[model samples]
Target: MKQLIIITFFLMSSVVLVAQPTFDLGIKAGINNSKVTFRASEYNSESIVKAHFGAFGRLGWGRIYVQPEAYFSSKGGEVFEEGTPSERAGRFDYNNIDIPVLLGVKVINGGMANVRVMAGPVFSVMTSNKIDGNDLLNKQYYEDNYFGYQYGIGVDVSNFFIDARMEHGGELYKHPTLDIDGKNQTFMITVGFKIL
Candidate 1:
């Protein structure tokens, strides 16, 4: 019975040593170019650059992993009236808290570097908004909460990583009395360091 107990203990130890999963906790900051595209032909949209900062945690087994991130982001765009007497332009700015949960696969897993692809859904809650140059626009024209999706590729070398992603979403703003409907599209690039 003593020999059998020793054998079981060794087997369990070996299993534990062989099945180690990876975990990473990190902080990241990035820039994004965002645009709100309107469906009405009379309005033209242009992208605006903004900053985002956040923290992230990743857990993985083998080449498969899940990452969750929370970040503060400012997003919006500039709109121009195409056929107006003065060609009026308006700017829309929104501050938000964004949370994304992603599933990723490491396509190239090496000893020193790795490349991965990830896709996920994101939830955004608007904390505030600033509208300029348009008297008809207000907070009521924008959404307080919205859902979006993100897909991206990343490269990790040692403890540092970089990611490039594209985000798209449903309607972000709709005017109650006008034919104005807008959706958000953004491209983002970020760099991060792993703390764990």
Candidate 2:
């Protein structure tokens, strides 16, 4: 019995020592109900659905993990103004391209499931029509180089995951042309296979 106990302990320690660290690579995509909110009395909120696609990777130790991901995102919105500069009603459109680098951590060790939170910086470019030649729609787009912030939470159950994230972009100068930024938030539910 004494010899069996010693051998068992040695095997467990060897397993721990030999279990090399690991990482996962996969894909994520989902829907974003996006809108632009203006600070001016002449404008109202416009919502649009833009698609996103990207790859992700995770690297760390034990149940604690550090994940960094990057993806391409389309964003924009539309609204009808009650009054026109020269007429009765006016129409406006806006579009942008965004790239976000996110850092995340898992808060639960749910065997095959866990909850995660991620945050990072977003780079955005105004990619469409301009209002008053000023791109009032982009009034929020062009002001800063580091145009936005990224933060989100979701659950991962082995082969599936879901989360909602908020981002804030554009400079509220000259025009209150800031996007719901994060308010144009995303709710993503994805199915993936772990590839290392």
Candidate 1 residue lDDT tens string, 21-72 = 7899999999999988888888788899998999999998878899999999
TM-score computed on alpha carbons, candidate 1 = 0.86
Off by over 4 Å in 1: 1-19, 85-87
Task: List TM-scores for all candidates, in order.
Answer: 0.86, 0.63
lDDT of 1 at 154: 98
For candidate 2, the 10 contiguous residues with the lowest summed lDDT are 173-182
- Model number with the top TM-score: 1
Best by lDDT: 1
Candidate 2 local lDDT, residue 28: 78
